[model samples]
Target chain A: MQVNFWDRNQLRLTPVFFLAPAMLLFTVYVVYPIFSSLWISLYEWNGVGEMFWVGLGNYIEMWEDDRVHTAIWNNLIWLIFFLLAPLISLGLSIFLNQNLTELRFIKSIFFFPFVVSPVVVGLVFSQFYNPEYGLLDFFLKSLGFQPIAVLSNEEIVTFGIILAALWPQVAYCLILYMTGLAGLNREIVEAGRIDGAKGWKMFWNVILPQLRPATFIAVVVSVLGALRSFDLVAIMTRGGPWGSSTVLAYEMVEQAIFNYRMGYGAALATILFFLLDIYIAWFLFRVWLNEKGRL
Target chain B: MKLFISIIVTVSVVITTAMAGTLKITQNSSNANTQKLWKEQIIPLFEKENPGIKVEMTIYDHEAYKTAIRNFLQAEPPDVVNWFSGNRMKFFVDQGLFEDVSDVWAKNGLDSQLSAARSTMTVKGKQWGVPLTYYQWGVYYRTDIFKKYGLGEPRSIADLMYICRTLKKNGVTPFTIGTKYLWTAAGWFDFLNLRVNGYDFHMSLMDGNISYEDNRLDKVFDIWGDLARKGYFIENHASLSWQEGQAPMINGDAAMYLMGNFVVPNLKEGGLSGKIGYFQFPVIDGNVRTWEEAPTDSVHIPTKAKNKADARKFLAFLAKPKVQSMVAEVEGMLPTNNQSAAPTDKFLKIGFKVLSESAGLAQFYDRDTNPEMAKEGMKGFQEFMVKPDREKQIRKRIEKVRKRIFKK
Candidate 1:
């Protein structure tokens, strides 16, 4: 029996055929590299030369390292402070998505940080954080307060970097929220208005339900962004004043590149990966729960 | 079909371009003078003599080149690469990342000519690279500012403190050093440790022979802390990069900077040389100032370099007094070769005198110690500057890293 060349079943398989290249790329670039990193984490290897088996030696060392403790603590600070970006952006999006004069111009001005590169942002913010003649110092001096060295102070260096990172991050979330707000259905808002729902009430009863997808996306992106914060800290503080501002990602790169401790860096990366995975699992679980309820 | 494709892949991997015609040199600088010496002076001269070979030079900024060197060395290596002497070079040498250039040294009689810098380029009894310029570190001061304050270069800690007091009274920072990248802090530690405890003790400590918490180091920290407490260092120094740290000196807000001879060109470029003077960092503990901070910048052939022969030719040329003087003159730095003519710059002349006469040379703290230890040491030094009271805590932190690194 001759098989039909163009049948419905084969046509249905065409999408899978189309997806094969992307799947292969994802497996090679993303999935494989991660597992390889895990594998390398078990060995003591500088980027060059020999690879010696070290098992859990690097992990044990990292466990006792004060810098690692500082990194984890700083990562926590980043996460907690990073939550402010989405919230601020939501408020910004709402305020700006109105009929105001030069609204597009003002919105673009708020969107400015997102378009600029992280390296430029870090450098610019460093000028603001400069001890002398920095904008921050100038403002403080103008206010009759002694200038605070935010980048130099171990206690507040990470916070200073976080504030700078939030500039671009909040802009990113603003753009996302703006897109979400633009697509808002008006009939439900009218119904909410008929019920005298306005402001917080309207937002809670009508607007927010529609914004759930955007909020979920914004939150996921924000959390991921917080965990992967390397550029600002690398460019600004270099995790200095005794490595007080280093997050795990920054510390990992420092160890691997600067210190030539590739195995240890990989182990740190593994730990960071697991930490991020915990948050991801919770997010996925929440989505699963919501999906099951709907089903 | 699978076998055919696998065979093709294996064949492609096995094939490498013939190593001839072009010599690739990766320079770790974008400085116009260094580039000019390479592109105009060195390359033209090299190609004119060889006639059969050409040069393809690639320049990378210092930091980016450092990170990129590791990868490129393993995959498709450059014929020559710019690097520092001492442990920085030793790091790559230990990994066999650098070619053994001892033959070049032997063939060119560079062993005797480059004797002063040989110890720095040598690792485990093998020389791996050649250096043309290595500069001395000392206090570069504002002469007009010092003269106006009726002060001279300090000869002792007491004299230094007197200058500090005068500068402080005048509302000027006694010294300006940016510790943003941490290495500037290492310069302070090196000087303080060398002055208080002497060279051998400081080196032993750097080599991980002595524990950081040992009482001997306490003296060093105590003396340094005394300076810090007296407000002798630039305020908010941790926020500035080493380059930015010069602002106070340029503006006459600071009287001095403890820095290397490489900064001589910068002073001239900034038009601040009219008021500048160079001196050895003031002595402490009544000990002879025997050791000097002399960091050497070198050229290396990566192990996987396609043109090792041409790379060796470049190395030998670099060892010659003529080529060394040409490059070092432009940079306003002293050539590593003892016979090379001193530059026209007075600051470099003093640097040459200090380096040549010093009983021994230190390749600076970061260059002398293991990279990991150097990084931690610099950070701790930075903290020691900011909070003198935390010296013990910082030492403890560094000691832990030292123990882990050295397996002591």
Candidate 2:
């Protein structure tokens, strides 16, 4: 029997056939693991042992856990400051893009940090911040200022690391903004100029709205990057200065892998995943509503 | 056709023979000389002693080694691997991943040759590994700085505090440390914990029989805080490696560094060997103390070892005095075997003396405590170093961890 061309069933199977590869990947890596973690989170297994069912004990204990609170606060700080990183870089990119002389070279140099591995960046910045023979200390001493223990002082430890983290993140944002600028509508910009819209007025009215796609991507990535800040913290301080820099990601690794509290760590990870999911959903919803309003 | 068949058969026989002769071993020790010695001396000796046994060894740096060992133990356990003693080994032992070496220990008379403390190599009354070497952790200081300031090696806590005050007066940092790795702070805490609480208390605390919030731990925190508040450590310690922090100590900018005996190599690498001096971590409360934080290294044969008998033979060969002494000489470590000759390296001699003379040897805090508890406890200790006022809170957190880890 010959199959009918352009039939509804054929059309329905077409979409499934196209999606089969991605669906398989998702099932293996994402969907299955989510349920596996959920099941594991209810047990008191140390990754090796007789798995004991503890019900919601791990999740319940997370409520009174101060480390979790510290981790959450650090995550919030990361999210807040991390957002500013891309904004500042975007602003810088726009400003730099306005000047055409040797711009590409300068942008490339600025973007160099993003190209390097976070582990290498962390090690380099750690040396730069070293108290005794570090460049910062030498500069401070030359200026007759007492050296600061930036890495050890709990009060400023997070900010110290954030500065290191920002180095690469800012570069990333600049690259995104630069790409967005390259694709900007010249005709619309010319129209704005004809309408006497220039400088801040032109940017606010013409350029920024046109850059929404880049801005949205930048924000989403920065938020996720900030929430998932682990490598730099691990390399630089290992969430130290007395766990002042203990973000959720580092804490999860510590609890699950190092401490062998696989169940508790999984619970922490699940919470972080859900938290990010909620934030992203809210952000996308806001952006969708804004677009609908524009329409 | 006959020539081609002969060549193919010869190739197949050679491949099979190579595969049959190969013996695999993994070690977590990161010392460069140790790796070199393993390749040049240990492997050759083992191979010579056991004809047709070709050894393949993989070495890991400290942190990577810990993670790699855990990974390997879970996935594909190696034939023979270096591991720590005390509660650290107990976890793997409890999993039945290690071969019981009680017969080997008894046959070789290791029980009487090694110290009672080394019994930590055994779990559930069955010996599971062969102890190779151990070393003391203490205050390694710059002799030039001490001589410049007319300060003697600190004999007591009062003397140490006085030296700290003197160093501050002389525009020198009293101590150099890098808490970036977190466990460096544990060296200080281990000394303070031992001094403040004594040996029995330390054992009890490690075994989870004592609460972390006990006044003894508070007193340890108070001492640590006093050191911090007094500006004893170099200004930017947190940014330095335990080795990098030694630069200030080497340059005479810093007076002392509380570190393991292994730090001597790094100090020497930075061109400060001859200028360095060692002292036992000072006594508190007029007590003449001889406790040392001695982390021991051991080799265990896995139950799933490809060549179990060959692996056991390699472990036995490593336990011999000559092999231990040769390794000690190359690695600048104190050998576990009493019959092994002392390392000729001056720094290693100091370590040997300290380890030999100690009234009691406690495994370094991280090794003495179970790995799970050690992870949280060390982090808490690092936090305590940064914010002393958080002592009560940190103690409570540690107590909770203790309860979770030690729960039956």
Candidate 3:
């Protein structure tokens, strides 16, 4: 009847003790903020003074807000175009996966964009896109064409910024793919070659399945990057020529900080969280399915 | 429990010791010259004059300070804070964030000394802060270009149109502006509104009393859009910043810029000192009085300030003619105190004269309006500048924001 106290509870207590730090941090910083932002969205707070209850008012306002519509459209453009990063980088990784002696130099050159900060990239691109003294204008003028001010034109400003964002993003995905290519199963490749699978067939049938984890991560990162695009838009355009190039994240910050509408900003943040959550849930479901198939 | 009690006691003692005889001041200034003036000159002077009171100053970057002040005012406010006059000041005043310092104004007789800026600093007929310095906004032109085109300073809308036509005929852009930051476009809107409808109407519009689609504003945009449509502004101006817009005038591609007195220093730094000339924005309506945009910077005591008496002393000291003149000289701005020595800089001198004769002062478009309205309004102005045909849509969009913010 007399049991050892440590032995009886150790199974449950050990895991809880070990997980406490992480769980505490996650709850405080992540879980708490997500709910708090949702709670804040149901009010009319200007960040400093009073918080008046106005349930779903902020979200209802979003339905009528033109800037919100523009932001959502821009976010869609970013997402669609961002998927190109992984596709382009996969090709780049494959091309660089050669036995040439100078491939290391080329690989490092390809990886250079990822090393630079986004702000630095944005500034450089801004200078490059300048109408009067920019490289783009210089090229256009030399080609006997009228210079186009890409960043100023609302139609093309988002695309111009996306191109700048893609420079670093492509390099990031390239690094991920290179690692995947490097860690490929040599035995499976040889067996595929013996079975007369060459070039695209060998890679698509054998190598790709092995690189699933890396592909998943790269696509997920790209999607996240596209959804949360802020710094480049802030630096290059400031959501201008009149809010044409704003994303949800930038609008959220702009509303909270510049416009001083904390409740509306929280509503924006909440919407973004839901969008990200849906993608994450789908990703988790896919991974669970894959694990079951493996089992 | 013993350790906890000891820690609490230690913190309280440290805080009280830190608070005693120390006056903390926070200012929004990113300029190294201003920072150095405060550290080496202003603080030293204040501390020297008051032997028992020590001055501690913190300077935040201009844009960062806008957001930071809101948080710090509620959490841990400094004794004195520097901010703009007009609606920006009224915003905090309405929230009871800033202390009413009419006593400081009355005791020092700033009513007459800083009369030009008194209206802006006053909200609900009580002075909220002490005006320190302000700079005028006008048409900064390339004097050489004007002379070459046989153009004198335009006195009326007709003369301005003639100047524009003459400049455009000579293959020179009539004006250079960068609407990339949006506020530069607001400057144009401010002048146009002030000139066409007058200051009272402009102030009412800024207060969200008048709709953006009002007939009064149609004339404002009509004049503005005519310039935009006539290709009077520098090409691809929407892509350029206020600094970048200077390149066109500096290179003589554009003839003029309707900008603040701050641009004079930039012009001087760009090595076009004497070549630049200041002129009041030309008259649009003969009957309407001339109103100038002069953004005034001032100091205030926060409601929760620990050492309010010392803060009042700081504000009073800041308002002194000698101190004002010295600070103004360092900042390359005109002193708000009329009793201060006249600015010796040529452009500053002209600005001071123009402002002295103006019917009333406006604190520029963005400063005089609700922050949300300012953001949307400036965006609309920038859009209108870029696409003149979109004026109606832009005005309607801005009107939507105005209605929401003002509950009209």
Worst 10 residues of 1 chain A by lDDT: A1-10
Model 2: residues with Cα > 4 Å off, grouped in runs = A1-22, A283-295, B1-22, B217-219, B285-289
lDDT (Cα, tens digit) per residue for candidate 1, span A190-287: 88899899888888878878988888888888899999899999999889877989999999999998998899999999999998999899999999
TM-score of each: 0.93, 0.90, 0.96
**Which pairs in model 2 have colliding backbones?**
A242-B383
Residue A216 Cα positional deviation in candidate 3, in Å, after optimal superposition: 2.0
Ranked by lDDT, top first: 3, 1, 2
Residue-level lDDT tens digits of model 3 in B1-408: 999999999999988767867999986888888889989988899888988788988878898898889989898899999999999999999989999999999999999998999999999999999988999899999999999979999899999999999999999999999889999999999889888889889899999999999987888888889999999998889899999999999888998999988888888788897898888999989999999999999999999998898899999999999999988998889999999999888878988999999998999888999998999999988888989998889889988999999998
Model 2 chain B worst lDDT window (10 residues): B111-120
Docking class of 3: high
* Interface RMSD (Å) of candidate 1: 1.0
lDDT (CA) per prediction? 0.87, 0.82, 0.92
- Which ranges in model 1 have alpha carbons more than 4 Å from their true place? A1-9, B1-21
Residue B325, model 3: Cα distance from true site in angstroms: 0.5
- Which consecutive 10 residues in model 2 chain A have the weakest lDDT in total? A2-11
